[model samples]
Target: MMEIRMILGLFLMITAASGWNVTFESPTVTVHMHETLSVAFTAIVTEADVANGTVVVSTTRESVASVDDLPVLDSSTVNDLVWSSNLVVSGNFLGNADILLSIVSPDQENKTSDALSVIVIREERIIDTLFTVFVAVMVSIMYINFGAAMDWPLCKRTLKRPIGPTIGFVCQFVWMPLLSYGIGLVLFPDDPELRLGMFFAGVSPAGGASNIWTVILGGNLNLSVTMTTISTLAAFGMMPLWIFTLGSTIFNSANLGVPYSRIAMFAVGLVIPLGIGFLIQKKLPRVSRILVRILKPLCSLLIIAIIVFAIITNLYLFQLFSWRIIVAGIGLPWLGYLFGYLLALVLRQPGPDITAISVETGVQNTGISIFLLRFSLPQPAADLTTIAPVSVAIMTPIPLTILWIVKLIMDRRKKSIAASAEKLQGSTEPIPTVSASTKTDNTENP
Candidate 1:
């Protein structure tokens, strides 16, 4: 019995000698990007063997954060050996990661502590604030410009035919949502945020830029404007319906109770600007024409600004970008363009109407997608998911730009040929003419 008790005591001592516990003043730390945070912690060593242990701190995700070793500030002898120190952490990106602390004893045995959660956030800047406000104001003005250019009679007539708008509606809501969902599933099967982002990008209404492109490419501008208006209005119901249904499935099959009131507010925001534009066109015709003239350039500038600012603000996300993400992004708008064109073609629509539908279908209001993601998801996730719309927005205009260049070249060539024909006609000598008497004298001499 005495020998058995001795062995049990030895085992207990050995077990205790290999065990250590670390406790932080706080279990979780939150830091801003480009900032540092210091956390104080205490390590309790119950055994004499680990009295001179070395502490090492590490983060699970290096991209998210970097943690420094625990610097010992003091040591004390009490019931057991205790060391107190501060763990220094630096935030590198926006996300959540785990911080782990381990102590290595003289015997090279390691004792690891429980994980500590860390969150990194992007600090807001003056430029971000200004950019948000500028986008809001510019979009409103652009819509007003769209209203100025709208032909109310033509819009009504297009509605009477309804084929063009119908095709656009199907393309915008049906084809786009499904395409985005499929692409998200195939490309980012494990990432729910990106999938949600793609889904929102698809479900957003057609932007006013569609109208600009239609006009630039000699499409049915009237129909494009009408479709934009209808699509914006329809989004009030369709967005939520799809969000609660298909969107929910993509997000772990959880029924996401989307904030309906916020969605309503957004819809109202869009409609109010459009209504203001319509009023300006009706009550102030001269101002409307001026707005119309500036619309194209202003919209172009806004597109550039959106791209540049989005890239600048979210530079960190670019690191997470992959070829799959790029493929998914390019697939959304490019496939949308092809699908819309084919659908319209199969329906035997007029060429101009086909162009209008294709443009409206391909170009989504990414601003709205970003807004919805921010509104729906929590911090970090909201910002992270924005990658989807931002990527799509960057890619959406490429094909349109190419088409615009082609149209410009063709127009110049046509003008050159017409000018050459005119010059040749002008330079050609008049056919030699003969008087009746000259002709008779020539005949007699012959």
Candidate 2:
């Protein structure tokens, strides 16, 4: 123990005696992908140290940024015991990494300088802009289909009952935002950008995907559609309200400005298509029915397109996904489902209403969140903040898929059993029954 302590003390003395310091012109540098940047740095050392030591600049994450010059500093670059060298850094990917300066010495001991932070951004291509526009246009068109599917009289009756939609509304706005905030606090306490992303996703309206999930999961399709419409219409106010109030704290922490105009535009976009759909539904019932028939497949296509385009356009973001981010992703929607379900169950909502509310609460309109982030924030941050929303969007459909599969298997088994029973009885009369689970509740009221 004594020898170990003495050796440790000697090593510390040697380290303290090796006086070498490297300082950069800037502590941090932001570069666009495929661009090269020369980072100027100065090192203070003795003549002998410079002669014996080789200065190497490298990045902690080579995938994010690569150092161009291998040996950035050496004796040749040094003058009068002081050396100033340029480390050429090239952005290879879109993310953050640390640039390290090190002095390797065989005669003495090696020393490494403090990290220089690098932020790499991917420039938005024309295709990216076009893709965003495409998403917006497609979503608006899908809302027309949404509108065609709405039964105004049934909507009015559902409103009269008001239990399911009311619960959905509260869950979507109240519980979701608060839950996301809490999750961000717990999971990513130091990352204000991620917290803001989660908050933005939380406050956004219910997605059209929720209605599709409801249809597949044998939920109240009427309630799901009605809630989706109501929540979207409400986003014009609710989103802004949340963003200005509690969301303001996160925005301030992240040094982000709330884009009030863009949000209002998003709400307006939803309303216009929906209004046209309603007109078509009421005036041209036949056309509305035709659109309604195609609505499911069209919505599925839209969902696929959104996910595929988002992934393709921001392929770099997948690299940013960490365990904490993944947990935040999975937790947000699943917790929303739990909260919505428990709330409705506590209120004695019928089974179908419970499913509808749960689906509505869990599935957020991440399109709005992504759109707002991309348009509102500048490059890099626009991409960075998107991680949270994209994560949630990707994770949101997983459980629904599993549930749908299980439900399909169970439904098939039940049908098979019914067929066997009919065969056993040797009856020619066919069984008058509904085999599929996608039935709407006869009573909209609790």
lDDT of each: 0.77, 0.80
Write one digit per residue (lDDT tens) for candidate 2, span 106-217: 7877666777888898876898888779878877887888888776777797899887888998999899989988998898776777888888888888887788899889
Q: What pairs collide in candidate 1?
A: none
Clashes counted in candidate 1 amount to 0
What value does the lDDT take at residue 181 in candidate 2? 87
In order of listing, the candidates' clash counts read 0, 0
The TM-score of predicted model 1 comes to 0.75
lDDT of 2: 0.80
RMSD of each: 8.2, 11.8
User: Model 2, clash count?
Assistant: 0
lDDT of 1 by residue, 1-446 (tens): 42343343333334444444778889988988878999887777645434566555556665687664446523443334666667788898887777766665666566667667888888877975676676677666656666666667776887998888889999998999999999998898866778888989999888767888999999998889889877876887888788877887765532235555766676667667778888988999999888877776776677667657767877878877889779878999999999999999999999998999999999998877776676556557667788998889989999999999999999999999999999999999988888999989999999
Worst 10 residues of 2 by lDDT: 2-11
Candidate 2 matches the true fold with a TM-score of: 0.74
* lDDT assessment of candidate 1: 0.77
